[model samples]
Target: MTVFGCRSCDATLTVPVSRVALPVHADQKYGNRPGSLAPALEPGTFAVNPLPSGPPWRRWAELEPGEAEALGWYAPRIRISAGPVGQVLLAPGDVRGAVIDPALVSDSACCGIDGGEPNMVCATCGTPVAIRIDDCGLRQAVWLAPLTTHVIGDDLGPHPVLDWADLIDHRPGIPPSEPGGGWHPMWAAAAGAALAHLLATSGGEPIVIPDHQVADVFRPTLDRLAGPGRTGPERTLVLAGPGLPDADGDLALIPQHPQTGELWPVAPPVRPVPLAWDAWRHLAFHRAPKPVGRSVPIPPEAPLALLPGPRFEPDGQIFLSVLARLPEVGQPWLRAIYDRGRPYSYTFHVF
Candidate 1:
């Protein structure tokens, strides 16, 4: 079963069975959210057209009589006569036509703890400062888990550049001590390069740079990309190392091309991942033997089990409905499959 919510009235609806058994289709009349299985009312069913400027659910009750009748006729229902695999009954008077309420129903749950302590206080005034500890025990618990262990060799050096290169070469097998490996100068350069690429591809938006001095190196490149005769916005730049300006501090730089005026940071050298024999040799020598997880099964056809019906709104309106049932472990894989199936929406929604 799947649940859908109406943004207007906050009304939620759940399709109780798999949609694959039905001959109905999915509708997108109400934005991109999940649609209902109810049909729209026919022409001349009401005294006035329900096409108002109000929200979608609000227009449901205003449907014409004939249209409303048509909607009522195609409302979804489960027949008891067919045993467990029951028939779909599309009738207006059914209570099952009502959309469910999400607020009243709990969707998911997790375990955690709460705190009531103040961690910081003013040195002179002695004013208590409120503090929030997001994950109290969960983080520490996971860190302490008895997973596969690695013995660190004495050959580990102090250089950041060599360490990072070595780390990348050995990843997907051995876990690095730090998430991004201990800070190194080469790491800083790589970070600068990545930041530059992001800014360039960001479609002319002025982004804050972390390293002002290094950013100064890339300004000309950014200006050329921004085009000529545009006054750029003032953005802050922060350097990563200590003795640098705090987050609140602002450092400004004048634009070189005053006429173009499009201020931008210097472009960092974003070197591509070298596929040379030396790089491959480094991996072959130091790569660790990490155990990989088993692969899950993938269906050749539709990955999700879909349900079908006429769609509807909270105010008793109708549209087409389709459902997608996915496996617990293969969600991403199945989602990729469904995304590829987007062009077939017409065929899937109708039949």
Candidate 2:
């Protein structure tokens, strides 16, 4: 767990927290319909959003020459944040030794705070140091004011990035289905992020993903997104991971390292698309070895299992959020899709 300190007093500002990659969809609305939005990072963890975010956004034309590209904006943006850089994000509940500044909170926003400025202050120095956001219809997170905090230390000594072989043995899996019977939120996100890569690498050609569950998750949208016929041969995407055979398809679906966020490297010509670790593990290794085509009859006393819902929609927000970051978005073909906001318009239900 890493610790952060208030820049003003050199006093500790946060509890020791594990660091994680900010979710690609962190800025995009998820769980915004028919339910409340949860905090971006879970308790005891934090991440840095490398991109500028929140308030005082700058229009593309307003950007000074060379400013946009330096900030990693390769393509034209309708509007981009000119706010604090490298904002630290964590659960609102995770904040410690701080108080919400009622004066800075937005009264017009419903449910809870939608802080654009510093709403959280250091308990010791009374300096405005963080922002707490919990607007009802939007995602909730506490973002530390950029210049107000500094790294103190990491409580977890020498955290090691696991080897792929070790990860297979130790890492836990995320359920594809949740207790209440819809696609698990993590599954929707994993599929959505991976789907963006599939489209980018598809070369605007038809893609064929053949693993039963893999195809089941991605095939519907792939068919829908492919435009009318060209006699071109199809492209295949197949699972590739540690302890699994080398992927023979045109594209290999691999797992990103849970701790390090590194992709399992593959050699030339076979393009790699990464899926979040737990999600990939669940898909690849969740099934135990069993006899094929040997059906077992259900016992008379057995309880029925809840089957998955017929429609499995990947969150479109997750798709577009990730697609916007990829270098492929600069291509004219993919650029058109990004500019048009395909995900928002597509009928496949976005979470």
Candidate 3:
């Protein structure tokens, strides 16, 4: 159990938080539809993570090299894939005297709850200490502000990244979709971010993505971005990870250690570029989203257990942090891809 306290007055804002399984979809939106499932984390467990919220960030170009490193290389770029899933979570009841900032409230919020914004405050000192997201048809929980709230308790430390072999065999259940119909938000976000990396891997050349479900989600973006008369360096985005067969021919974007956010280093250190965490996982594991609007009974012997992976966005702050540390950070095309994503928005439209 952990205690989340105000950094200013040391006021105990919350306590006794146990870690829980991170949700499958960090950007999940339980619309007006009824019968949404319960919170992702159980009553006591919670994860601590930094998000794209709080103060507006300065652009990477605006900062000096030393200043950029000091700020953790997290530019103010927005449209992240999902929130960071860390070994941190606190129960709602454990939170005490924490108040919500009215201005942060969203009109689209369910029952006055903001999904993941820093809308929560410490009652004692009135500091924005956390983010409370308990909207209807959505998960209910709190994400403590890393700058304002400190955790006090036993630190269980970081978990190991799921091996590619383990992940290939392990598949999680599908998330409840938005009422109308569409691919999972996490999948879309992953595809969007992956497309960004695919472009980077191509070195501004024309590339091809094979047909199928993954292509279905990603083709539109690629075609739209690289339509007629557009020509340069390009490469194919293929299925190659830790467990799968070795990638042959053209280059591949490999997986990252989910827990440490470390990109899998390709041997010989040439070709096979590194993509963000969730982007690689989406290709390595979540390539096919489960069929929505239906249920099928599984035999008891079937390996239907969901693996432990947090709701993730490849473009999330964590991904950008890792990218900032890489040699390709200076590449003009990569910078353009990152900049192409809208500011402060989660959705990306190629057209």
Q: Which segments of candidate 3 are over 4 A away from where they belong? A: 1-3, 8-53, 56-111, 115-128, 134-141, 157-181, 210-213, 229-234, 268-349
lDDT of 2 by residue, 106-129 (tens): 776666677667888899998888
Candidate 3: deviation at residue 110, Å?
A: 8.0
List model 1 lDDT by residue over 275-350, tens digit each: 1122113222423333358386443332221111121111101111111211211234323322333322333221
CA lDDT scores, all candidates in order: 0.24, 0.74, 0.53
Quote the lDDT for 2 in model 3. Answer: 60
Candidate 3 lDDT by residue in tens digits, 13-106 = 8656554334334434433555443555445556544433444445545555566545444434432223233324455666787888887766
Summed over model 2, clashes come to 0
Q: Residue 323 deviation, candidate 2, in Å?
A: 1.6
Local lDDT at 84 for model 1: 19
| Candidates' RMSD to native | 27.3, 4.8, 8.6
- Give the candidates in order of lDDT, highest first: 2, 3, 1
Name the better of 1 and 3 by TM-score.
3
Specify the highest-lDDT model's number.
2
Error of 2 at 252 (Å): 1.0
